[model samples]
Target: MIPIGMIDALPFGNSRRVRNANKFTELKASIAIRGVIQSVLLRPAADRFEIIAGYGRWLACLELGLTEIPALIKPLSDEEALEHQMEENLNREDLNIIDECKAVQQLSAFYNGDRQAIADRLAWTMKKVNERIEILKCCDEVLEAVTNGTITVGHAMILAPFSTKLQQGTLSKILTEKWTVSYLRERASKGQQNLALAKFDTAACNTCPHNSAAQSGLFGLEDQKAACSQPNCFKEKTASWLEIRKAELTEQYGTVLLIQQIDESDRNTVDSLVVGEEQFSVGCQACEKRVVLIDDRLGRALGSTYENQCIDNLCFSKCVSALTSPTPIIENEELLVAALENELGNTTPTISTETAPLKAKKAKTEVSCVVPKKVIETNKAMLRQTSVDLLMPQECFQLAMTYAALKRLTSNYKSINKELSNPNRFEDTFKAALRLNVSDLKAEIQNITLHLASIESDQTINITNMMIDNITFAADAKAVAVAKWIPTKEILSEYTIGSLSALCIKAGVDKAMDSKKEGGFSTASSAGKGKFVDAILAAEFDWSGFAPDEYIALIK
Candidate 1:
């Protein structure tokens, strides 16, 4: 037995950060009734002893005010100490998976990332080592949640492959919505696109661990069926392949039509072009209307395409009408010519080359000076205010509106208001020695009062005009302010998928996403927009001049 005071815990001794309160209480009770039954493992350390195992038992003994603990003191290296600590923690019924991950990570580092060696040392299967190490990819919040028993290790594993911010957001949803492990498992499995239908090369996916075929060894699968675990990667490669195919089609056929870009009513397939008695047109191959199409099947077939379709149904209908219509002929050419000239004279006059440029320039000048009826009405209303004696009331209103708009538009308004709360004050020590006569002073005061009312009237006019116009210079200025606006998942959730995709594409977020990972581009483009937003927030990227048109339209 060694004195409890003389024994110290090694750094890796406490594997669990959060312990079950009931379990700890029961342990203390067990020790109090039976005293120390099992001897703790320890090693000699500079006149004292360092605990190799049984740190929890040592803690229970100390809390009970016990002076001595039964222990077997032996000299062990750091590796042996860590192994013993892990063994003791693993034996406990209430060990947190996060603590297990931390212990495994330490052991991994000890062997310099030799997975096989670490697995052998811990007497665990290679698959188990791979699974535990993958759990480390989860964000801090997820790991903490697992440690706190808010979520199971299965949930953590499902969320581990995604980005950190996504993991955090998904964890919150899992708890609040009480998402079942089965639902997550189903979602994880069903979200994958079939490898057999993929337009891209399947060579790389054959060896990828994210591929179902590559996981047969780890998962102990009887069959080596192929499927993709990383939907983003699959989507990205498929999109790239589709683009390459589009480029080739564009070279062969002058025009390539995207089926999604055409309206349902305007699109026609080659098979549909064959009328009851009419045969399929062979000339279509060489005609100008010979267009190749790529169809996405309304997002059902995300990275797949359908070839050889026409978007111009109206043109085909016109050709058919021309072929079926009867022709009319005119016998008197001079009479027809005279009739045409008279009609042209009454409706559309021909302008000489020299006069055309002058007419166009005059028309442009007239158009530029013609103010919108809305702006004119606002100006006229402000002009009717006779009480205010100020020049250019409209310009003054514009200046005041601009300043007010800038403050509200920019997020710095609150900080600027804080600065205004405390202003430097100075006393006017020197007063004017000469005072104006009573009549002059009264005239001056009246003039000042009139100017103040003019400013007030300008403000009132601006407020009314803003509602009528619904658009102003302020909206464009707001775009500049919005450039500095950082987007959160909540903020992004307010936008539709189409709107978010538009904003991300315009901002070159797809390219940025691709730069980070191999299949990131297509995955972010087609999958949830939240991943793009999360990546932007994580990198603290300077998305300068990035403003959603809808956001600007709100003010307009």
Candidate 2:
């Protein structure tokens, strides 16, 4: 026990307070009631003692106007004192991950980059130590985002697996748009963590911290653990794994097989070597899943469902044979689902009171590794036996595209189309256009748990022609076009308000909120318009076309 006056802070003191410094009011109250619970470490200075730790206690004593505080006198060098201060603060205070990371790094450097020494001194597990240091390895954008309040440690950890450019863009969208952590998490994990669900890699997914399974405690909440939190990284890894497998298979088979971006388009789609190799045409079974095609949104994405693919059982059996187990590097969705159910395990999340059931449960079927191809096949066969008009997801997706395409091609629109301006009219017209009487589209979607996956570049060009040949539109196609366009205003109001605000900021627009009342982006907002400004700009999702005035008119 000693008087507080006996121990001097430092010759320069630590400015008494730093920015974002934690308040000591609670500590002050505690000491005022119970006195100092632990003694601050002190070392002999020139005339008095210097505090090596317990700055909070020193502050508390000062706040309580106490003449003395408990002190443990020790002998330490300046560097040793700093180390003690850092370690003590880290263990005591719930420091942010970035600060904790920096402190860990300083300790490592102070000990000549000795991992074991740092771990031993800090009394931390090597795993924990290594993980903390890993945070410091993130790109500057991610680190800065963490340092500021832009992102949580969990977000940074997930982003650590992606490209630097992607991290920068994702962080920008997150911060500028004020997205919820849940939304960011869901968006980040949108696809099968970049590995197609059809060819999901269970073993890699199970062990990766980027996998929600490996990140159980990362978010400090059970439900908050997102699945495949780094889709970009997952996609890259899956692609590399596929390439390595392809090479090995090529070496074994003594010829080339499936090539081109994962969507199987003709850009690099047709192999000259395969021209003479018609006898060895292995399969285009997973062709759509294995190629990348450019989208109308000017982005590279996967292809769509292939129904004209008329193979049914024959193709299915062939796929099974080619993808049988113990075969060198062949992955299929059902097998991945089997691994998920048996190996990693899938627990349906308990519904949370905080989140809306619509949003929370929208993802229920999505995160599951269960493959629906067999189930859908069974449904199709049953439907074929009954009436074939019961529309499945594949059928519905094609219908939606055909409707959009037909509308685009249709020219004549005048007063008769005015009645179709209502948003509900589009839904009705879309169903009417589908021409399915017995099937309820919404129910079918829910039952099948269908995602369109991708629009497939070929569909965009040929859908109108295909639809014209098969079914006829009820009203003037222009009215249907107007109906499809009607939903545009609803999407603009509901989804794109924040997105527009974000785009405006990226375009260097001034005070985006000034136009928020009407939910419109003004030309005066910035000089950057029409042109995509950011590397990963999302103008399509944000609602482009129709200037501020014209768009407001349309909405009205």
Candidate 3:
């Protein structure tokens, strides 16, 4: 037995936060009448003992003016004592959900954010631990509702992801209108912002009440774990940032193309801008169709400016289609001026009579296609605010695939397929898109642009192939050297046996083929060139390492 004064009570224990006043009162009465029926568990703490369990029994004995009480005293580490307290509290039937969550939170903090340790010590599932920790993000008022039995733990979980103001507002509706858990969930889903795709800087979001990370006090969220509670603020910031970026680029270059979101049905808009694979050139930056595809979602998510690619799919086909047979295909005023300035150092070159007809033809084409400024501004405004609703489940799946493909095409980042497949990733990817309103069962998709040149060209397979080619055949000589461009039977069919043999020799495959049989090259040659071609194709070697000679160019 230990003296009652030697034992210290928990500062925030179940006994202090009464869930059932009558039950606690009866316990105290029972203790007074029958003495302490159960011994309280305690841990030695220097000069005194700390209650590890049975807080109510200890409190009742202390109130009854008992000088000594039965106790099982043991020496335990801080972590062990916390585990004991949480285990005892969690098993109680009358423990308030709020207090239960707080106990779990304290245990979590005691282990320094090692949730698995808490789970293991308490023999709780990781999912249960995670849910309890998430509930701890709920504001004091929302938690109070859970304690008061006005809302369930499920309602608090849904409300935990939103701001305190939003939580309070939604709580009033839930109380006045008697909303179900599913309805509250639906409302919360509509207002979330996926921080992964945000265009603007999010350093301030760390402390903002509207961010889930701030609400939970979580830091360094690299994935879609963090979300914005205020969708309107996120939308306005993205829109404003994109506009400012566009303006800055426009000032640097005469005209810059902006690529945002476009509907899959309106494929012609991006199709008109990007027609073919236009090679990059120093003078191409001066062209009106130079693209600046703004992928605010990925740019902000990955913390990379390279996510905003400068697509150089110049309007090559568009320009060629505008020219007549008499006009030289290379007769663009910008190109001509650029070339003259490069060769003659600021000398203004006069237009020869021979070029007059070409200039006149170009002028006619420009005048014929002139759109009014008001019409252009209206179109721009409409494009800026575009939203798409994907109704079918198949459509949603297809969009997810497209999003994965875009990530591959536009950046060096890889392995996003599994990430996008997760349900939470899918929700944030679709729900928090710019101008996208995913309400209830419906999803509004936006913020996708395939081409910066023309909205009509987004659906063009040619542009997609061009992008693939551009990455596959990179600008760096070393990258092209190691590119995995192995020749298939179809590609080999284009090359003659002589060319194939030459490439095989360069790759050291000929030596292996010749050594396989006596007089192998002679025998294969005598049988016909097909034998040699077969030998080259069947050779077990790294074909990607081989590059054909310049003399064996494709028969274009």
Candidate 4:
């Protein structure tokens, strides 16, 4: 078996489907532990292989670090290869709904040319299929929901009966209100019936009694003529006049009533209120005279008509009261101060006198109580002098291994805590980090870890596992395992390398220890030196060498 590094990726095949399936970390782990048992199907190419059936297996093997993966290279025509590729993907359970719908449509066309039969084959009724098609006709609002995986086919089906405009409006409202599918369905049903009924009622009201009253002219001279000529004309005239009278009374009694054209400006204020030949009239219920208050605008009679009626009596009383009322005046600050001093003169005052020394002591106590606290000094010297030493090779190795193990544990934790975190798997992130093989950048790693901790605390899901997995994959596991034994933040804050090395040996990784011919101290020193050198060499490379010039230039 060749080393896994020698194998190249398969060419001329669908990469998207392969990548999606490989997102299953369990599958990747299985391939990692067990050698690839089955071979992938491929079509023979000039120099490369065209993957047909086992794309997932091929990706898994690559991830597992297998140098030469087992592949069954077949010499098939283009048409045959295409058929095999399609069949393989068709069998996958993770096929998206859009693809499934398109497949049904295509297959239906290929078979009996009847779409309904195709829908039947899929266990979906003709109506259901039609609804799905209608969802496709929906505007961006509904389509965006489908694409974003926010709304399901069932939800879209429920909305199918609505016209595009209505669907868009409803969809917007649903999103804004954060409504569930059930709520949306209920609202749609009720809204449709209510909207239809409202339209009908509004159309009917356009010709109803209240609306037609203004157009019927019963309050005008035509109504007066009708009243004099017809037998029931007086009743009709009274009804119309009463309706108009009630409206005017309602307006007059309403809170914060707007008295039409009552100018409050100094010059026009009283002039605008003056009543002239233009008479202001309102029908009164007390004595229906269609009361015309004339002369001044203050509801006063112009002539001596209906002098004994209740309307005339009430108007005269109101006008006389308003004319005789006193004008109001506002007081200034000097007058207010004089009034306050006069009020204070009627009250008694009390006084307490303290002896000289006691009074001085009381004043001092008050001053002290009112004063603010003094500022405390900070240990800025110690803070400025702080420096973190780079981790030795073994320490780095141990950390990487611990990160990998933690990554594996995080995956298990995520499965149990599905709703608690984001769906991005930590294992994948760890694997990527491991691929980088970082060991010498201990300070950077520590900073990153601290930043990540802050992010993990705020985020729904823990990405710590993915980060650890990536670091472990990039670095040597043996060295990482040794580093894991070192003291954590609390212990490291006080202890130096000499104190920590004993702890490392106790935790294991003493296997790589140097000869102790001179002494244990000498051996430990040698080991530390070797590990540090290894870490430095690993981190010194120019990573730009591996990237394309275009990418490097873009970064620059």
Candidate 5:
């Protein structure tokens, strides 16, 4: 046991095999409760001690604020320390297969790259050591699947003999279709003696030592060479030869192309294709890889567009890669110029200074696009009005509705324009636009009604009623808010009898009734609504006293 200073002298590769980060907390707690039960292993160094196997215990000691840790000191070289650490970590039952393989690799390095020596040192058979080593050579997917228990180590061994592409396909099928080991073995065996490979040199394959059919010393004493096997070699060579031919065809045609299968029903015309009875136009212009044909013999012999069909009738891999990778998006001239000053400062030497005058001239030309004086005045008149533009949008919208309703009540409302002393063109525009706005409002209301019908809830009625009240409130608020001088008499004709009664009552209707005889009340009622409305508007009135329902009723 010796004193420990800082916990930095040792590398953590051998000590880092842990299932969870909670183990650190648990180790720390254990040290706090009972102190380090096992001493941290240390190797002698120039300045301090290098940790061998007890890194967690050291960390726990450091966390407990203990300056010294109980450590077994050993005078050993780097390889000897690493070997000791690997042996210590590998003995732990909690080590996963990945960490186990890594420990084995480290231990093997200690034996001067001799797996047999490592096997002898650990008392593990050479075959078992090699089997675990081969696990590392398998693809990451296979490793993950094996670790997850989706596929067994035996399945990985069988798949290890195939090409990476085939291995990936088999893994995908195993995951998607839940393939059994026997099913995978059968599928793999069938491909080894396929009809495609049978045509090529049978005599050569029968006697060939590389062929799996030969069955002698298939397992080499050294590392296995999966690519040198019969089935894989034949397929790879054939693919390479065809790839060369495909490249030649591309060179002859002088353009990239994409080949797609067309349904037999739609094969009469060269202009289009069909996929399962659904016709799609494949015009030369629509083709993504329509090469520019030089007007030569081959160009004339075949049309301008050539389908990317290979001699073996397979879609090219490069075409799929091209489809997956989109073309770089380019910014337009307008966008470039707009952001040019921010993007390219005066210090930037990329864009030439000589072109500055031309750019400035173009900018001036764009800025000088003439707008007519009439249009400028009209726009100013539309937007600059303080009286109308200052009103809340909701209030203005309601006023528009009121005006539209009034215009419908009065067929010749346009002729009866009693302009205010201080004229408002907005009110005049509202009167002019009344008909159009009414149509839009009706369509909007219809859509709202349809939408409301689809929703069934306890709040539906409340929501609908609230919407109605809001629209009515905005319109009524704007309608009675008189500015400058209003033509109250002209507006009276659009008002209903209920509105007339409300207005008259608001204007001291009881007082008017007292002055006139009670017998004349019947006369006033019988005189028709036109004269009564005129009389009511001519009379001095306070409309503010009326309820909102009564006030808005005039517009309705």
Candidate 6:
């Protein structure tokens, strides 16, 4: 091995030339800053040195303007040098994929007679070597893409299953359209047969109400949930036709008829008028129950429009009016007489001389109206009876009375001038009267107080157990003190006494020792302090020492 002057261009082989010039530039920058971390391997030839490995470094050194470089000089046969060169280039991180594929292919050819021998020498699977050989069969475009780093070998492998023309088409699509390899694979898996087929027509989508609603942004999957829970549930569309009908009626009619009004007599009539299949129906057996109904058939029809589909009662009523009205007939005789003279040429030609002119048959009546008073009265009675039945139970009523009395007394006290009123005197008198006259209320209050006390005692026990488990005697005394002071409420459920002690041990209590570092006296600070005080009381009563790490962990 010797350090020699750098050669302008080392002749290894024309086939093994650099593909990416930027890679050499990066190497030059790295060499300038940190010098060469590795030395090039070379073999002595008949007249000069031949590079066995480290072509990238050789180029980088050339770019860096280094006149000479350190080299590992090794004597080897042509076959051995070539094998070492392939291994070295294969190991380089920045080796271009095309160059690697080419090198692997040549190595396999050179060592054809020795398959296992080559595999062991290269430290690669026979299967992998075979796959690299197959990669060489890919068309020039695909190979060029692989060389330029536009597509990965994995992507190439997916494309490998397709015909060369198909691969080229897919590659072109990917490059032009920026399709991801996964998306390509997904499309391919769907089969190439469908790729040429026309996509579904947008106009065809108008046939589906859901598609229309989605396009218009009027309804979505979220609104669908609300529709399901509504009184009218329709399958083909999300919104109930009943809701649309109500909105329509509200907009068009001066007033919408009460559900009771429709249910009592004309719900069937309205359903027959609204042009759709009935989805939901409700009827009240007593006092004319108001019922909400949906027509799913109409919903499907209007939903297809992708816009407002309101068709209210008012519109239906108008249609009914048009159908029932009679055409006008003229009753004036002057016009009739003129038309008769004009047609008959002033003829009063034939006068009927029968005994007495028969009177024209009387016209039949064409309109009728009806009203029901008994039904209205019955409905009012039912409503009043239901209201009375909903009163509170006897015990709840008694409790309410006691609460009212207490509230009244409190209100009267509040109204008094504080400067003139003796609150202590008022409280004492009130307490005495409450105890004497409200014995049951007093007992209830005592029970509540006892229950709260029990809960507090249990919480205190839990906090004491945590401090004992977390604190260690070897920790800093101040940190121990701080850990003890941390409130039980502040500790997360996962932080047992042992864990808190470990945390205090990690965090020294130097801050706790400084008076200036104490948190301020705001409501939040007070609550925190209260928690710390509770923890401290628990620790002190249990004779637990603080672990600095445990305390610090808690703080963090």
TM-score, every prediction: 0.35, 0.30, 0.36, 0.27, 0.35, 0.31
Q: What range of 10 consecutive residues in model 3 has the weakest lDDT sum?
A: 258-267
Query: Top TM-score: which candidate number?
Result: 3
Model 2: per-residue Cα lDDT over 198-294, one tens digit each: 1335665667666656555555856434356665675565556556554433222222222111111112232213221221121231122122221
Tens-digit lDDT track of model 3 for 196-312: 667689888877877776545347544446788786688678768877775554333323322222111111222223322122221122222332333333233322222112221
What is candidate 5's local distance difference test score?
Answer: 0.46
Question: By summed lDDT, which 10 consecutive residues of candidate 1 come out lowest?
Answer: 425-434
Residue 513 lDDT (model 6): 22
Q: Arrange candidates, best TM-score first.
A: 3, 1, 5, 6, 2, 4
lDDT of 6 by residue, 221-250 (tens): 342211111111122122344355555433
What's the count of clashing pairs in each model shown? Answer: 1, 7, 17, 27, 0, 31
Q: For each candidate in the order shown, give its overall lDDT on alpha carbons.
A: 0.55, 0.44, 0.52, 0.38, 0.46, 0.42
Ranking by lDDT: 1, 3, 5, 2, 6, 4
Residue 241 of candidate 3: its Cα lDDT?
Answer: 83
Model 3: residues >4 Å from true position, as ranges?
A: 10-19, 45-48, 192-556
Give lDDT: candidate 2, residue 209. Answer: 65
Tell me the lDDT of candidate 3.
0.52
| Superposed Cα deviation of residue 174, candidate 4 (Å) | 2.5
lDDT of 1 by residue, 1-556 (tens): 9999999987444544557788878889999999989999999999999988887788999999999999998898765776677777776766766666666665543443457887898788999877887787677798888877888989988886555555777788899999988888777555655577676789888878788876666656676678787877875786687778766555344345444333334345543243211212223332334355564321334334444444434345544443445244444454445446656774433433244322111111100011123323433333222112221243433333333333232321221222222222110000110122334333433433334423221112343333323223233534433543445666554443333444565567756767778667566545554565565556434567664433333333
